[model samples]
Target: MVKVILFDLDGTLLPMDTDAFINTYLSKLAPSVAEIVDPDRFVKALLTGTEAMIRSKDREKTNEQVFEEAFLPLIELKKEAIWPALDHFYDNVFPTFSYLSKPSPLSRKIVEEAGNQGYRLAVATNPLFPRTAIHHRLQWADVADIPFDLVTVYEESTYTKPHAEYYMEICSRLDVRPEDCIMVGNDIQEDMVASEIGMKTFLVEGYVIDRGEPHYRIDDRGTLEALFRKLQRKEGIFAEK
Candidate 1:
């Protein structure tokens, strides 16, 4: 009954050396907020805020609210002082790092094929960044022009990936059951963990990150080209019996 297909960004939809992009992102981000905090403290505060989001069980508060509660304190500034820097970073700096991500040449085509087959689609990237940042990455993947039923942005999302609630929230919002979705991504832990909530898992190739741990169940594994062909068929992926 797979009514929706959840695609992870960073590695799944937007092919990228995640480590390089993240490191570069960290580097660029530090400079943006240098006036508010030292590079070391800013990174620490940022990671601490991210950790807060991951550890949070509160579904009522958005990740941004949770992040600010933990982050703005460390900088000794209010949201007004810090938001400008972040806004400039995402608007100006973030887009320039497309070099870090490998081109997702098949991204738009794959989504188009999936849509053609009557399946709902979403960009289920981890809800760490604001919508502005996520939207920019969507452009990098060449799928910004395509509409999705859901795009998990930190401003609205209460949880991040790997949490059962995170996947559950999506199903609840989309008005579908967990079993009615396929969570597709390249990460071993963050992406595949969607299977823990009864959603099917598809591990995209060439950007695997299993972390040497016991892996979760993956219903399928292959390149996006392979996925595209699957969509072109009448049976479709996760066809009804």
Candidate 2:
């Protein structure tokens, strides 16, 4: 029996103009730290920190720790100085970009559908951002109100996606076997990689992202409505083939 459904936040559930969001994020981020570091250098260092998190396979340090070590020294300030600025950015400026996200009712529909079917849910987004940042995006997706068994955030997550260990870590936290879970997302490479650990994969076609490297099997692919239909089947999509 499939007891859990892992959902990707950005393109899979939330319809986003990724470029627009990133541009806006960078545009705002530079200003947030302009007082402490050269705006251009800050952006460069921030990207480095983010890349460090993505490349990291270190289980001993949280993504947040990895990011801090990589980011702080570049600014020539203690974490205490630059930290509040990023926090302030997420609190004061980040939500304004919610307008960039096209409203998608399907995001909520899928979550509610899975919940009604008794499958546990997770907001399995890449744990690259702080919880508040993720929470804001979740709100923009219109599915923040529902309780999820896990909402992977950088402060706590040791691994980032596209890495099987990341999926395994989530499975470990939820105390569920990978085979008894479904990883649902739009990215062919990043999200579908959950299959490496025996999890079923579902590609959400509404906002498909196929990087074409490290290809993996997806058990199903369709719109969120089709997923709702799958949940309604007599034996459900979990039936062994």
Candidate 3:
């Protein structure tokens, strides 16, 4: 009964060394906003804003709103003075980070297979970035063309991963029960937390991040090929549900 399949982008669909990607991303991002704000303060504000998004629990405000509320106050420049720089960075500079993420042909295949089988697809990446940045990363994975029912961007999401509300919100938007969705990701703590509200979970191997014991048993292994084959055989994680 898995009507929706939620895939995490960074480590799951797009293979990456998380730390290397972040370090390189920040190194590039810092200079892009340097003319408007000091590089040091820019990084600090960016990190602070990200933390605010992560810790956000306000159901009424989008993550972007929460991030701006927490971020703008700390810096001297107003949002109007700095937003264009940030937009320019995402449009022009962010694509350079594509080299940090590996392309996955299987990602597009699995998403296509899911869509063919009548399952709704979503990019359930943690919503810390703008849609443009997420879209660019999806392109790097070669799955950007696949029609995803939902892509969790900061402007749309109210919570970040590891919070059950995040999953709940997605389910609500999709009009599907938690038990009828499956979450596939490499991070045990962030992705598998979908199980807190009854979604089935899969743990991808290569970039797996296990923090302590996982909250729920992983329902299946996480290669797109394996998942696709299992679905073909009617033996997918929720096959019996």
Candidate 4:
């Protein structure tokens, strides 16, 4: 039986052109930090920090720590000197980028239905952003008020998506086997990697990031929503699987 349902935020739940969203996000973020550091250098540092977070394998340190360690040195600034600006940017400027994303009513319905069926819900978004930034995006998806069993954020997660360890970490936290979890996302490369550790996966198609060939067969969100309805009726894919 599936005990957990993990959903990806960006392209999956929050309808968005990922590249366009990032471009707008960084463009806004650059100006916010321009007073402390040059805009170009700050953007480079931010990307470097994100890369560090993505490559993080150290279970001892959080992704936030890894990002800070790599990011601060590049700009020759201390965390004490830069954190307030980042905090302000996320609190003030980040929400303005909500215009770049469209809320999916289906996403909310899926989450609500899953909750009603007693399935644990998790926002398994990539942990490159702080919790505040993630929370704001969740609000845009209309799932901010829906209680999530777990939400991956830089302060709590060490590994990023596309890494099997990332999925394993979530399973460990929830005290469930990977086989008992289902990951739903738009990126074939990142979300489908959950299958590497034995989690079932569903790929949402509209904003798909298709790579070579997926390791597991992919199912669309429509099929998944139908499956949810069937599960509610105690029939269909859930019963068969």
At residue 21, candidate 2 shows an lDDT of 87
Better of 2 and 4 by lDDT: 2
Cα RMSD, each candidate: 1.4, 1.6, 1.4, 2.0
lDDT-based ranking = 2, 3, 1, 4
| Candidate 3 structure quality by residue, lDDT tens digits, 3-79 | 99999999999989889999998999889877778899988988999999999899999999999998898887789
Clashes of 1: 0
lDDT of candidate 2 vs native?
Answer: 0.88
User: lDDT tens string, model 2, 1-241?
Assistant: 7899999988878877677889989998898788888999999889999999999999999999999999888877899878888889899999999988876787787788789878899989999999999999998988889999999999999999899999999999999999889999989999999999999998888778877687999888888777766766623454534
Once superposed on the true structure, which residue ranges of model 2 sit more than 4 Å away at CA? 234-241
lDDT of each: 0.87, 0.88, 0.88, 0.85
Off by over 4 Å in 1: 234-236
- True-structure Cα RMSD, model 2: 1.6
lDDT of 4 at 229: 66
**Across residues 128-168, which tens digit of lDDT does each residue of candidate 1 receive?**
99999899999989999887999999999999977889999
Clashes of each: 0, 0, 0, 0
What tens digits encode model 4's per-residue C-alpha lDDT throughout 1-241?
8889899999888879999999998988899888899999999998998998888899999999999899999999988898999999899989888999978687788788879888899999999899999999999999999999999999999899778899999999999999898888888889988888778777776787777765555533444355456556755324535
Candidate 2 weakest ten by summed lDDT: 232-241
RMSD in Å for candidate 3, one decimal? Answer: 1.4
